[model samples]
Target: MDAAIEQPTVARLITAENREVPVSATLRYRAHDPLAVFVDFPAEAALDGEAVTWTFARSLLDQGLRAPAGHGDVRIWPYGGTRTVLEFHSPHGLALLQFQAAALRRFLQHSYQTVPAGQEDVGAVVERGLSALFDEV
Candidate 1:
C-alpha cells in the first residue's frame, strides 16, 4: 500500500439495466511494485468487514477473472472468513491502472443482474458480465 493510494471508496450507481447497487472500490499495490495498481472489491455487498475481505480474495481464485492491461490485478482477502484471491493480469504494468469507483459499481450491478437468481457457480456469470461491460464501453 502506498501513501498516495487512497483507501477503498464506496458508491451507489445504476447499472445498464437501470438497477441500482452499492459497490466498494479500493486501490492497492505491492510495496516493491508501487507503480502497479490493484483494484479490489468485496465478494458481496453489505458484508461484514471480515467476510468482505475473505470473499474478495476467494472470488479471484475461484472465478479466475482478470482485468484489462494497465488495470492492475484484483485481490480479495479475509478478515474473518476464508480469504479468496482473484487476480487479473496486466502486462502493461500497474501505473496504467486507474481505479474508477463508478465504473466498478456499474460493472458489479450489471453482473448481478445478468446472473440467474439462486444459481451458484457465478464464474460463468462473471465472465459474461465483464464481457458485456467491456462491450458497452
Candidate 2:
C-alpha cells in the first residue's frame, strides 16, 4: 500500500467581505497516521507568506460531508447541494474555505483505498508515536 495519499485541490477562501478567493490546497492522509487528515496550504495563502498545515480527525471529515461536525478549532458543514464549508480558528484569526463536495468525497475514497475505514492500525500508530516521544526525551 502507498504510504500516503495526497489530492491537490482548489478551495475558495471566503473573505470577511463575503467574497471568494481561489486558493491552492492539498488534502493528505497517511497510513502511519490512520486517524488523521491534513490540509496543507501554500505560502501565498498565508498572511505571513509561510506554508501552514491543519490536522483534524478523519472521521470528522467523513461526518461533516453528510452534516455539520466539529465544535472546536475546526468546523465543517455542507453548503447547499454541491459545496462543503470548512472553518478553522486560530489565535491569529479564522479562515473559511469552500470546496466542491465531489472533490472531498473523491479524496476520502482514495484515502479509504489506502487505509480502509475502521481498519486503521491504531496500535501501530501508538507504538510509533511512543517511540518518537521517547526518542526525543
Candidate 3:
C-alpha cells in the first residue's frame, strides 16, 4: 500500500449570510495514521492566512456519510441528496462547508483501498509514535 493518499476536490463554503463560495480542499490519508483522515485547506480559506489541516477519525467520516456524526471539533452530516455538510469548530470560530457526496465517497473509497477498515495495524502505529516521541528527547 502507498504511504499516503490525497484527493483534491472543491468544496462550497457556506457563509453565515447563506452564500456559497468555492474553495479548494484536499482529503488526505496516511498509512502511518491509518485510523484517521485529514482535510487540508489553503491559506486563503483560513482567516489567519495560514494553511490549516483538520484530523478526525476515519470511522467518523464513514458514519457521517450515512448520518450525522461527531460531538466535538468536527461534525458531518448529509445535506441533501447530492451534497454533504461538514462543520468544523475551533476557538476562533466555525466553518460550514458543503461538498459533493460523490467526491467524498470516491475519496473514502480510495482511502479504504489503501488501508481497509478493521485492518489497521494498531501495533505499528503505536510503535511508530513511541519511537518518534523518544527520538525527540
Q: Each model's number of backbone clashes?
A: 12, 0, 0
Tens digits of per-residue lDDT for model 2 on 1-137?
54898999999999999999999999999988989999999999998899999999999999999999999899999999999999999999999999999999999998888889999989998999999999999
- Ranked by lDDT, the better of candidates 1 and 2 is 2
Compared with the true structure, the alpha-carbon lDDT of candidate 2 equals 0.95
The residue-by-residue lDDT of candidate 1 on 1-137, one tens digit each, is 21333346554433447564666656442322221334555556423443223123322422332332111455422212321223333353221122243444344443334432243445654776788899999
What does candidate 2 score on TM? 0.95
Comparing candidate 1 with candidate 3, which one achieves the higher lDDT?
Answer: 3
- Which scores better on lDDT, 2 or 3? 2
How do the residues 61-91 of candidate 3 rate in per-residue lDDT, one tens digit apiece?
9999999999999999999899999999999
lDDT at 97, model 3? 96
TM-score winner: 2
In candidate 3, the residue pairs with backbone N, CA or C atoms under 3 Å apart (3 or more residues apart, or in different chains) clash, namely: none
Tell me each candidate's RMSD, in Å, in order.
Answer: 17.7, 1.1, 1.4
lDDT of 3: 0.94
Candidate order by lDDT, highest to lowest? 2, 3, 1
Alpha carbon lDDT at 34, candidate 2: 87
